[model samples]
Target: MSEATANDFASLDAGQLAALRRRAILSCAIGNFFELFDFTIYGYFAVAITRAFYPSGSMYGTYAAFGAAFLMRPVGAIVLGAYGDRMGRRAALVITIGLMAGATGAVGLIPTYRAIGYWAPILLVLCRLLQGFSTGGEWGGAAAFLVEYAPPGKRGLTGSWQQFSTQIGAVTGSVSAALLASSLSEAAFYAWGWRIPFLCGFLLGPIGYYLRNKVAETPAFERAVETRTVEHAPLRVAMREYGTRMIQAFGLSIIGCIANFIFVVYLVSYAINTMHLPSSAAFSCAVASGLVVVVLTPFVGALTDRVGRRPLILACALLNLVFDYPLFLLAIRGNTFKSLLIALICNAVFQALYTGTIPSILAEMFPTRVRYTALSVSYGFAVVLFGGFAPLISTWLVDVTGNPFAPAFYVMTGGALSAIAIISMKEYRDAPLE
Candidate 1:
């Protein structure tokens, strides 16, 4: 806050710093793009995956296999999160993408259940574990890198690129799935065509790794390194020092994660199943929703820079609370264009108001030393708890209750929890990150 300190911070706002900032966002966003493209594509292809692996007529079994990966996320957070805190964000970013890409390509290589017996699902689970573990570290490091490297006035805009690229990944996955399913014969798709997307994921990993490798360590991290301020045991210090912030992070994260998984990933199944919509229609709807988010997220991020993160976040939660049930009802009203438009509207709201702010809000929570660790743990644990199994849970809720709109209640409940956390936490927009 002092004049000398302000001057020091301003020194990094030079042209070279601007270049670093752009490259940093570009690299981090690409990494996130690949991670999410792989992530969402798995969901998009879950039916084929289950038919190939589970093959028992239980889709939940497939979703459960999908959920199994998430259980490893918290563990990945602790291990790789610490690596990011200590070794540096760029190094951790490269490692996470390498693991993600390998597992993704491995998913394509596994033999079908009929071909390999139970080994098929076993291989699937193993690949999921690797993907989950690596994913645990990717977002935390990317968010830390972007927020730390960002110039003061542009943190929201730069950080928004993280989720902006996430929607790009989602859009790519949905569009790819739609095109593949539409183009391929049913027998061919179930047999081997589903593997193409996973195999394609191999190309992105190397690109993401190359980009992250080219970037410098964030200035905040470099300063910590120079001052010997890096914590040797980052997770321990994070838990001891920022327990409340971590708890708040979980609270804040729950609804956003639910909204994302539900609207983006789960909606594919929800439309195809509960509403009995055509697969192509459902896929097209998902693609439209993703495009909406991709278009709108950056504007929302810029708005947060002006109005601060708290208001938009709270507004997002409140809208979900007030409109979630109605939104679900609208989505199920008919298998028409109107139905898809309703879903797209909900996706737009979730993306612009909530998802856009996640990187900035989360990065601003803890100091630089333990920031990545805290974010990884809190966000990872929250996703494992709710986001990972969201589709499974939504499907189960519908199966058990026989209410087609049962998933709405889950998102609505998340809204209430998020409201409480937002009320409890400090509004830190434009505040010093460390």
Candidate 2:
């Protein structure tokens, strides 16, 4: 056996293994946390970005810019995901975090339309596209890193930290935006305050790079490398061997992606624009709702390890399908902080269950050689089609239909699609990773 495989993880004592797992989790999760924060802050400050970049009379331009990055995700997934399979998970993760940090920081530094005219929005879209590409590579690598390190029968619980860190990043973004908006004068906020969050996102890069550098590459990937099982063309290999599994992964992701974008990212806009809530109230509701996901998701993930993945996934999809419209109605009727909180929390509960389980399921669907490429491409496609533009689509749907509840139907449709997808999926909770 090669040196990489000769240093058997099985030789480590319990404490040594535990320490390694913790380091791996922290290394992977922090980068994902930063990546999510980078994206979440953009969504949180979309309105300010719209005013700053788009001289065009339409907010659609800004939303389109926001969605544009997602268009590059699949390309990134194919390119970077293959890089992970060929180079190593740690190398791909380190590169992704650096790219994300730089792209995110660039957004804060770009001159506004007032100064740069058309160049301002153009630069902003480019930054977003870079962010999208970086994120495309980050998620699958992180998921694979976490699951590959997980002890047998504990993959669900360990993998769930990926989502946990995501919620934490999102909550931090919401709270940061809320605090800045509440504390700064509207003139100051609209002037320069919004860029602060993006600038701070830049600082996350060095930290994530340091953390990832400290952790060893996953044993699974090391074994693949040692055994010469790493694919030279992982994306092509994945498509040829795992086409059906890729579709299953995409279907499994649809509702979670849509619901996350709508309930978590778009809800702030919905509260402010549709319900006419104060920005503070809107952000506060988002923070509370995100906290719900943050706290419950690990528990839900742990539960899946016990009860099975399909049950919770089915429950999440079915509940969202049935109750999304009613929950939207409940918020609209009262139009109060309490009602919005309740509605958002209910929506968040469903999201937590789905997010908690989906990462592990996606990671489990393919063999080590193509795991990164297959899962990332599948997820990137799903997010691009359903999640990435969800806020923009929801905004447009409500605009054209003149019905605030129209976005709820969009979310419900995702739930239905996901339900069908999960119904046909074989349970892989206890299956040994190849």
Candidate 3:
């Protein structure tokens, strides 16, 4: 979004800057790839996790535990976001990846309720809390790192690597789940097979640590330090200086949060449990949707550079608002993988518009003085409120209201609010970052 399209390489040669950009993007995107990989597995296989950690008939409590991870996110955002702002983005990124990898791996190794009774579920919750805390800082840090390292005027496309990598992670989780579900017997899947995905998450720590450490610091963060502009108390500075913008960021993020949770987290389980579809069907739908988002995100992100962020997001929100009910109805009516795939692709297109542009939009909002803290805390708040609770709330709504597609109403509400927020907020797609 920075209007300064000219290179500011800090006396580096063109080749050096280009190499730095590639490494920076790769490092950040891989961290994001792992974060979403583990998180998506947890959501896609929530039913199995619940069974492993809780008493047999505790669907509601399982979802509650799943959502509980979100509550810790804001706390992590405050602490780690400040760490990024005060210390450095690289430091925050390294710590987040390490914490996330450890917690995720630990979840797979924990004893089941059958083995350890109540302590099993409690331990599961603690691991999720740690994962959630690390994740709180991951996105904002990645976005800031990439957007800063990006070639001037090319932030939209570079920033979108974050969402692009996220979709890669989503696809990995879904495909892995589908393969295991279709191959292994249900008894095996619920027993030991499920632990494979979580244990694989442990690889994230070393890979991410090595990649992040290999790259140089971003141009923006380095400049901040050189100019002595980095704040000592970024949280307080952000709250006091950019409070209104933070609320606007929350509103803008709400619909994307719900849409993501609905498609990536809740929809698969809804198909498997509520519709009695095959587990493979749910996994297929997730992979299809993630692939679509992955393909569409970078193009739309690049489009935002030409057309501005407002129009793209407005189109996304309006399309989502108009089609939310119909998309669900179509998927419900068919109750087949093909039907769900079509519906998900449709939803992913509109969803991509927001996600594609959002990294640039978020990074453009607050000045570099508190960019990481501002974006992290606002995104953390939005996810905790709408994204995390979506699974439990959607299930509860269906149970109480007897409407299987009750979640669509929540999506529509978010769409309307998102449209309002976009119209009210200033367009910063062309503004300078600092």
Candidate 4:
């Protein structure tokens, strides 16, 4: 009955709606890619970084330090998510990208432990925290921006591109790091070769900034502001009105966090440490899996649009539970390129189902005023619980069980938890965000 509601209803036509949705998807995806690239580059280059800064330390200690950086992510999410609700999604995104770029560029220039004593690790942790904070803010803003601009009938498809961008960034970071590492001598790679990917983030940052600036504010946000329909305190309102949805989001995110940390981070470590594969080979597998994820992400997104998010997410979770042991067994036992390929393929396919639909589903869970806050808080908390701890937990599990397949069981547990959570969520495809 309101003017904004009337406009939304009128804008649901097929032709012009398609064009706007495309623009939104492209803008959100490109901007998100840069943010994720900066975040993920650390994981891909963690070994080289550890050697440079913690040369005499145990591998577990080095990884523990790395996980410490992940702890800052939820704090960033709470701060920036609230800001996005109060200020604007575009402003939050712009700020986050700038922070990520600055932190990443500084990483390239950080002195080695030999040069700065304890100051080296201190600086590294500081920069990583800043990067975590920036990325924490980036996800919710980007998701809300894309989903709000999506066409009525195709919101899931358009929103999925935001997740797809993460794979694009991961692939880029892995390939670039592999190429740079390979091109340099071992001595050179340890000495100075590892900084290239971090430095590359400088170029990516500005490009993301430019692309994001071109995107208009989402119509949903604009309408809420124009009509003063926004909640007085979005965080409180979300807690009061949408607490159950927040819980659902956290559960739905478990499998994705598990898959990403295991396949992308833990697998890289496992290949290098356990299987004794060359770092190049390990990175190549990661790059290959990322490429597969990027390609399959959109298709999964489209599938969600047709069939709904609940079924797709549950199916992926169930398949992950079934394939968990076999996938890791293949990757570890054979330790061949072929084995890695099969494992990576299975992980990527299952991951795509959840990743592709999450943005739209989360955005649709709340009204425009609180969408960013709700999504960011729930998502960031899940990352802290599931993703932030996954690598460390997987390593600890393996050490305790002395079985290489321990990580597979850990991964399956997460999938089972997610399946239970997602299956209970209320369907909202036809529900309007008022």
TM-score of each prediction? 0.95, 0.97, 0.96, 0.94
Off by over 4 Å in 2: 5-8
Per-residue lDDT tens digits for candidate 4, residues 1-434, read: 24564376356777766676677678778888888988888888878888888868446655665676568777787888888887778878888998999999999999999999889988988898898888888988888888888767788887888888877988899998788767888789878988988998976799888777776667777787777776667788899998998999889888888888888888887788778888888888888888888998888888888888788888888989999889998998888877987898889888888888888788888889899889898888888788877888888888898887898998899999999999899777667866
Model 3: lDDT to the true structure: 0.86
User: All candidates' lDDT scores?
Assistant: 0.84, 0.89, 0.86, 0.83
lDDT tens string, model 3, 245-302?
9999988888898888886678778788867889977888888888888999999989
Model 4 residue 175 distance off true place after TM-score fit, in angstroms: 0.7
Candidate number of the best TM-score: 2
Per-residue lDDT over 111-164 for candidate 2, one digit per residue giving the tens place of the 0 to 100 score: 999998989999999999999999999889999999999988889999999999
Arrange candidates by lDDT, descending: 2, 3, 1, 4
Model 1, 1-434: lDDT tens digits are 12343245447657756776788889889889998788768899887887888867678978887888898899889999999999888889889999999999999899988999989898998999888999888878888888898777778878888889978988899888888888989788778989998999987789988988887777788777767788989999998989999999989888888887777677677676656676677888888888878888888888889999888988888888888888777777765656756765675666578767888999999999999899999999989888899989988998999997888899899989998999899988978976
Question: How many clashes in each structure?
Answer: 0, 0, 0, 0
Better of 1 and 3 by TM-score: 3
Compared with the true structure, the alpha-carbon lDDT of candidate 1 equals 0.84
Candidate 4 lDDT: 0.83
Candidate 3 ranges beyond 4 A from true positions: 1-9
Judged by whole-model lDDT over C-alpha atoms, candidate 2 comes out at 0.89
| Model 3 RMSD, rounded to 1 decimal | 2.9
Q: List the residue pairs that clash in candidate 1.
A: none
